[model samples]
Target: MPYRHTIGSRTYRFDDLKTLLARASPLRSGDVLAGVAAATYEERVAAQFALAEVPLRAFLNEALVPYEEDEVTRLIIDMHDATAFASVSHFTVGQLRDWLLSEAADAEALQALAPGLTPEMVAAVSKLMRNQELIGVARRCEVVTRFRNTLGLRGRLATRLQPNHPTDDPRGIAASLVDGLLYGSGDAVIGINPATDNPKAVSNLLHMLDAVREQYAIPTQTCVLCHVTTALQLIEQKTPVDLTFQSIAGTEAANASFGISLSVLQEAWEATLALNRGTVGQDVMYFETGQGSALSANAHHGLDQQTCEARAYAVARRFRPLLVNSVVGFIGPEYLYDGKQIIRAALEDHFCGKVLGLPMGVDVCYTNHAEADQDDMDTLLTLLGVAGCNFIMGIPGADDIMLNYQSTSFHDALYVRQVLGLRPAPEFEAWLQQQGIFDEHGLLPASTSSQLLKQLPPALR
Candidate 1:
């Protein structure tokens, strides 16, 4: 039997609760109350309430009475939108006191409602409720300190392990490290390749997902951009995948064809949506084109900035409602460092603040050879940040060609710390010195090796 949980005399089954909450319109009080009452277990109640579209604290405030302080605190912390709770009138002192002092309230009931709630949780919720931004200086200091320790060759080599292939055992090692580095620091997002050619890769990704779900409990989604074969395979298998879509290669011929035919883009969009609907609850992500590495290459292939943006806008305009409000993903220029303008044009013209009518996220490719240089990384980071991208994606190893020959271990760690605001360890100094990046003067190099950078495509250079 599935684990169950209860809240306010209502019991629910876990799976049922998940399905109910996953529904698009989950805020109706009658629906919630009925689901809660029909629930057969406590976890069901918890999941239903936990995954509700409305904030958990707000729901609890409106639905329950004779509340426990600790339960209210936990609900606030568990709420995805704790910011919404402050305006809720039920949390006022009078209401709280009334709920606390009411004869219907029992000490045991309060304890059960918010089991193991801590003072720290209460303080977090309280601060969030008050609309106070937590001081970010301490967090920044932590990242810098960590970076200082990881500045040496020994540190670099420690992270240079290459997995033979994407499989459960090897991928778990990667996922654990990545998850540890990224948890709670919202600067980076992970994407898994669900290519049909390699079932092991998909299996490995599932293993990674399990680890992520079990350990960090992150709520972020994944997007699969693959060919038709992989898309159909995943759909046929009835996998509860998140988003699946196609990857279009950018050549002059394809670009011209795309320009001439709205039907082509429309058909692709309709087909993806149809697949998604058939797959139960998965979403579809659209990409404008793949790999615009050279000006001449793009021009020769009919995929200049104008054409690229035009195609993106065509798709964005057609599916504005779905693309704008939905969780969508787009890839930026791959194999082309100078393609930032193309990226910017696409965003400004089709994606930026309008076509999607929502915050559109652009995924940055790790193909730039200068990824190791702090200056280069910083420039890209600043560009993406300014471009209003929601997240960045890259592989985890240096040897991965897909990552543009970048060292995944060092660069990935550094990028996460710099952009995501994760806390650093004081002992990281000893760790970095062990890696030998520091000279006798304790100063690290300002840039990566030119030889390494030379290996990158000229467009990326």
Candidate 2:
């Protein structure tokens, strides 16, 4: 079913929401003031999605003048008792720029205030803020470095294969991996969350990937992205556990889903290190996260989803994961809600994680049950490509068998790189050229990749 946006017994529906977006009228100052004043938080958020950013920001600034002491003012900017900071609307674009660009800027205060605004408002604000503050905000936020420039290279983007299957069958899994690798993927990590969590099943999946990696002598890493405990179990049993996987959320309660705590993560980190797989040398954890995970687990910690996600990055940076990705909209529409929200959170998470000192990738994906589609993913991938994202999912035809959702495909990755003039991570790029899977430009068609594919074992072929 399409994700239900209804609050009560059918107060809203997919069509009604589409109508709301389609009918978004030109907004004015008084209308914004009155709407925020009278509407519930959910409705205000809906309005934020429907309204255009520049017009909404302009009118919100106008409304801020007369409604300084009102709830309406919170919509403009949640001061949150930052009393020295008067109404944000009072600051000119240049003054705001000075505050953001100046060394004395209160980054915590600025980030704290960000949750009150929509991504559109943030983007509109970005227009005035420009590169220095944008980069300053990115740095102050603590995005990890050399992520975009790993191996002393810049604009070197990356991609990974999900290689999921309905059955945890080795043959099925190998076929998917073959498809991804031949199409020029697996540069990020060939990590999989097996459909089944049985010990035998999980072990088999890991063994299969490790076998393929060794058989092909693939330089990239491999992982089974199950819960940390499962990975620990695999490691204890002497299976190949190259990376530890965990789902982290902003709040403690939400983290219960993965049964992880700071201590548990530390334990996994120590445990993985003790194995000394050293896919990247002491940086062997892979984490999956999204904006709505905290809320989905009913543990948002009283923060916005984006901020909650960033806090998860705090936990991620501790172990120094080689890959930390937000599945973006894969959790369904409840957290991200729609394409616009999904796109915004993708950019915000990438920017925030980069600042937080984590090598971050964006899974430009959405669940089939969610109110999003491939077109939305295209926009997100393009924007992330421009933003210098580290990686995106490269699944066959954008289909994830375990998660059963749509994501950027192998071809989609090629589309972005071709459009942006990006190449795969250096080692992977060299391998592709040697293998003839892709030229210096982009992925060859399957007929051409088949030239390399023919070299595989008959079963894999």
lDDT of 2 by residue, 1-461 (tens): 11124444534322222123212212212223223121355543443333322233343333311334322223223422233334454554335445556675454655454433333233333434333344446445423222212321346678878888877667777888888898898888887877777777888778878877777667678877777888778788999887788887655567766687767888888888898865434567788888767656655433335544655665666677878898888776656657776776677677656544467788998877677788988987887777677788889989887677888898898899889888887777877777778887777666766644666734465
Tens-digit per-residue lDDT, 245-355, candidate 1: 443322323434334233344454555566443221222443433323212233322222222222232233333212221111122223233333323322333222221
Could you give me the TM-score of model 2 versus the true structure?
0.71
TM-score of each: 0.38, 0.71
Off by over 4 Å in 2: 1-153, 445-452, 457-461
140 Cα displacement, candidate 1 (Å) = 26
Residue 265, candidate 2: Cα error in Å is: 1.1
What's the distance in Å from true for residue 213, model 2? 0.7
Give the winner by lDDT: 2
The collision pairs in model 2 are 142-355, 142-356, 142-357, 143-354, 143-355, 143-356, 143-357, 144-354, 144-357
What lDDT would each prediction earn against the true structure? 0.31, 0.63
In model 2, state the lDDT of residue 140.
Answer: 50
